[model samples]
Target: MDTTIRQQAELATAEIAEVAAIPLREPGTELVALEAAPAPVAEAIRKRMDELDMTNTQSIISFGSAAQAELQQISQAMLADVKNKDVGPAGDSLRGIVSTIRGFSVSELDVRRKRSWWEKLTGKAAPFSNFLAKFENVQSQIDKVTDDLLKHEHVLLKDIKSLDMLYEKTLDFYEELGLYISAGEAKLAELDATTIPAKEAAVAALPEDDKMIGSQELRDMRAARDDLERRVHDLKLTRQVTMQSLPSIRLVQENDKSLVTKINSTLVNTVPLWETQLAQAVTIQRSREAAEAVRDANDLTNELLTANAKNLREANAVVRTEMERGVFDIEAVRQANEDLVATINESLQIADEGKARRAEAEKELEHMEKELRETLASAKARDASSDAGASVPTA
Candidate 1:
């Protein structure tokens, strides 16, 4: 890692941490009460109870009814925005961007080379340009998305503030409902245990004519108490709704905060790291290409030198041998001279044999002529003797 780049990264991380840090409330100092009420809750209940006289049951009933309406409004207002929101799509988009970044490869940016000698020596710096163009394109997408995320962050921050206000108001309504319910229960208990019983006794003691009026008054008081009980029940139900809203508001706010922090981290840290790593990858790739070219050149040079040396050795050997030799070798001349002498001897022997055969044929012809002349003479003598005998006698 470069010193400057490392420092910049450290600085970016620090900035992200500082910017994203949130101030937290101390443990057990929560404002919303779920189970147990504190001193303030007790005081609020007592004060609400003091506002209504037990004899005026109508007033107590009115108080609970009003509280019920108010709590319902608070709960509805707090949950209005919560019901329509979903954070899933935003998370999906972020994940897709992260996947795209993860899928990036330095190999994709490499220029394909034919690796011929000329191409190696005069190769353009296309790899660097290719890497730069691709990096810029990726960075551009990230920048556009980050810009959108920043806008979303601002909107989410505003929403957190809005939810905070709604949460506080909901808590107030919860406590108010508690006050209404507690006071209504106390008034109901008093009427059931003491007031109603006493009224019944007073009516029973009245004379026949006055009993009807006292009984009617007792019935109205009982009706008022029942109405108050129903109102208190409604108030408690609204309070339950408010109770549920508190956590929902908090959950939405926390989700927005988490997304904001993630956006900040991407802007400050992850993007810069990508740039740094990509540059390093390109640099390393170029160095490798250069080293390969040098190695190939050395190997080619070695092969050419080896081939030339072998050709030179063969040419030199042939030329030197030709330069040292006679035009006609003595061995070839001696073999041809011996072949000519053998041909002369064979011709003389053939001529002598032909002359001896001619002389023998001439002697044989002279002897054959002499034998023919003697045979002719003997035949002539026989013919002459036969002729003489024929002329002399027939015996």
Candidate 2:
């Protein structure tokens, strides 16, 4: 969607086009024919064929891409390498063929060429026949090497392609997995933002779950909350009662003590002190129960938060693990691509360079060969001239 990506896409398209135009021909057959030729004429025909041969670079590139994929898997394997790096090997092989092409140039062909004047000068002489033998041997050596290089490349390319396909599927898996992780993270953030406070609020409302606890406990908590509310109301009434009673007690204090003197009873009134004690105890228990109600609310809220946190943490762990796997995979794919390109380029360059050097050497060899033939002819002429004068004596 962005400019950089768009540019890359365009470049890929152009590359595909360029590679498409490059033909991938197997040059070994021609080389073999040249080797199998018994004499100069047959070999010359084969040479012409090779000279005219074309290559399909695009197909080679396609095959090279496959090899790249295989290398990726092999490089990233955590397990016993059940899979191999087919692409790297295959590409190397194919590129080697490309190298072979450059290595055996037209000069090499010329180096092996029949001297154009051989038919006229030597006909089928043993020396001429001997030259042909040596030529054929060299030709066979070149063909054998070429065949091997091409054959190896073909096998490797197929394997690399298979690996490449698997690599693609692996990458797709990571992409989908990453999306799930991203979504999960977003959900985690939302949960964290809302769950803590929401759980607290839900518990405070004396919700149905709390209302169901032990049935008896639920009733007690409700009773406690209600009593607190009611006591506040009751305290209003108690205020009036205590106010009136307080005035009376004060009045009693103002009156004579002998008439109001209290009597202690062991049998019927000994427990009279228990009334004051029991009233005080009941008041204290109500206050404790009220405080317990608020504590229950907080504890329930905390329990829910702790449970939710556990689930969230588990979910996050899964996402983190998955993301790490994806990251590893993504890096592997990127590196594979880089290696693939380098391999192809290096192969092409090697082929081109080898071809150039071989061509140059072949040309120089051709020139030397021509000079040797010419000098030999001149030497023969001199020998004939000298022999002419001494012919009688030699006989």
Candidate 3:
């Protein structure tokens, strides 16, 4: 990784290390209360045991009962708090914010690119302004989510402190258990070493007939010590619970503290940085769009001016040429006169050919008429001759 990132990681590790250095009461350390006492300690311990209520099991177990009950409550509270306070949703929201940031882009912002002519002239684009409004709304949402996370952090910190107190309470219970066990052991040792032996010797000195009755006190003392031993065993069991609970409390507190640290970092470092970068990106994008719009406007203006100039040049050339011309040009009049003379000459030639064709057609018609009349007269004469011949020779 980068050196800066490495340094940051080291710093974070150091902070956690410092926290871990805080002393915790090690399991079974309370056993030291039962360590070997000095030679003179037996007499003192015996006197102390004499003051205790050896026969009352209820009184003996009271402190242990209280310790166990409180430990149980603490454990339950820790479990319930762990179950009820979920950081998952907050973490998911943070991840969602990251995804949103990654997905967001200036180009995704709605911008009316094709504006009216008046809008173009006014140089007013609503895209950036609208983006600002939307960004403010999104910022509000981010703030709300962050605020909830901050509240969760506060609750976790408070719970962690409560767990610290619980840890101390567990240690106190452990020490109480050790004291009860040690005191009970000392009493047991004294009963075995001194009290029971003395009682048995006294019973031995009694007459054989009364020995059984005389040993009753001894038996009673033994029974009381047995009850004391049982109570101490109960206390030891309670201590075992406390031993286990210490680490559980610490682990829960550690988890809560770690979540608090993460939330602090997100709120103080990551979020502001992300927002700042986003704002800068938006500003840069708007600047780019503005620059592009100006360039496009300038290009469009240049194109229109060039086209208008060309059209104006062509229009002026046509109009000026038309203005310089006469109403009727001499070349046009001369071409018309030549065309009229050729037309009249072609008409006279066409009329003469028509008259000659008509006169030939009349001569042809007269010749046909004469031929027809001559053929008819010949036929009529042949018919008369045939008739006269047929009548004279009536054969």
Candidate 4:
């Protein structure tokens, strides 16, 4: 009989132990660790929790309620921040800068290549020099503005990324809390369905048989019943706590989801749309400025061409007048003939002097020859008279 009671008590103790272990056997779920969140976000949550008196509270219900309220406030603030931030003016400024750059680029390319005829002739760069100076100034301004815009964009994107991370962390916290609450509720339900019924059956069966009524057996049975009852009470308390926290957890989850949706809309839709529109506006402004510059260049070119045409026409008219009035006549030809006449007169004078000298010399020569012939004749006559006398005597 003792053996049978001992077996029955062992079975009861085993059943009670099993029932008591149900809640403890649940997997642990927890909120997102504060350390995992960004420092600024973590600090903000800490400040909010402090304001709600959550840090010192031992009541899970109170803490959950306070946290939910804080989370809601944070969500609202984030949404307001996003909604109220203004980037339109910055975008307009960027557009203006880009337009100026485009205008300068177009003007530089056009005017530099299309120098006026006067500009080319005089080798003066006044027109293009002024334009280049203005172009450099505008380019510098564009560089500064673009640098500033990039810096601002970087900061804004960083802030947005941080906010997105905070939202995700908040979502994780609420989801984890919800899972914990759910698991707690399931443990309670399981205890009610299985543990409580087994204990009741064991208690009811205790008085059914006299053989089960020994003093030690009854004490053991009573102790087991009391322990089972205590376990049920503890589980009930846990269930109540979890039930009380459920509303707050669900509230936070809903609020977090809403905030996430808003943030995602801004990141994917609103911000992108704004950027696209700004780009289109800048493109349009640039195109308009370029077109205007082109028109101005065309007008300047036409003016230059017209002035060149006028100058060419005046030069052609002068050439025609010079040709028609014999301004190109050969005065040198007449001068050359006058010089030839003077040379011919000098040559004739020289020839006449030579002829006169030659004639005089010829006459002198004839006189000398005649004088020699006369002398010879005299000597011959003398010789002949002498010879005749000698011959008359000697013959």
lDDT of all predictions: 0.69, 0.43, 0.70, 0.51
TM-score against native, each model: 0.56, 0.23, 0.53, 0.27
RMSD of candidate 2 to the truth, in angstroms, is: 62.6
Runs of candidate 4 with Cα error greater than 4 angstroms are 1-67, 73-97, 107-130, 180-395
- Model 4 alpha-carbon miss at residue 359, Å: 98
lDDT of 2 by residue, 1-395 (tens): 12343243334344333422433221111111323545763544333323211133232122112323443454466224434432344345335433533443322222234554865476644432443454445345434433443333334333333334443443433332222222223323333466434544555676677745545444443443343334334433433343344334333222212111111011112222333443444455456557778988999999999999999999999998887685458778999999999999999999999999999999999999999999999999999999888866652
Off by over 4 Å in 3: 1-30, 33-52, 66-107, 110-134, 201-224, 295-395
Candidate 2 local Cα displacement, residue 366, angstroms: 99
Judged by lDDT relative to the true structure, which candidate is superior, 2 or 3? 3
Tens digits of per-residue lDDT, candidate 4, 210-245, equal: 545544454554454444444435534543554444
TM-score of 4: 0.27
Whole-model lDDT, model 1: 0.69
Quality of model 2 by C-alpha lDDT: 0.43
Per-residue lDDT, model 3, residue 203, is 90
The model with the greatest TM-score is 1
Best by lDDT: 3
Q: Model 1: which residue pairs collide?
A: none
For candidate 3, lDDT tens digit of each residue in 8-100? 433554454455456766655635333465444544444445556655656554524544567678668877776545567767767766665
- Show where candidate 2 strays beyond 4 Å: 1-131, 200-395
In model 4, which range of ten residues has the least summed lDDT?
Answer: 19-28
Candidate 1 residue lDDT tens string, 10-102: 454444444336432212213333225568776676677677764576675577555445545644764685543456655765776687577
Candidate 4 residue 122 C-alpha distance from true site, Å:
26
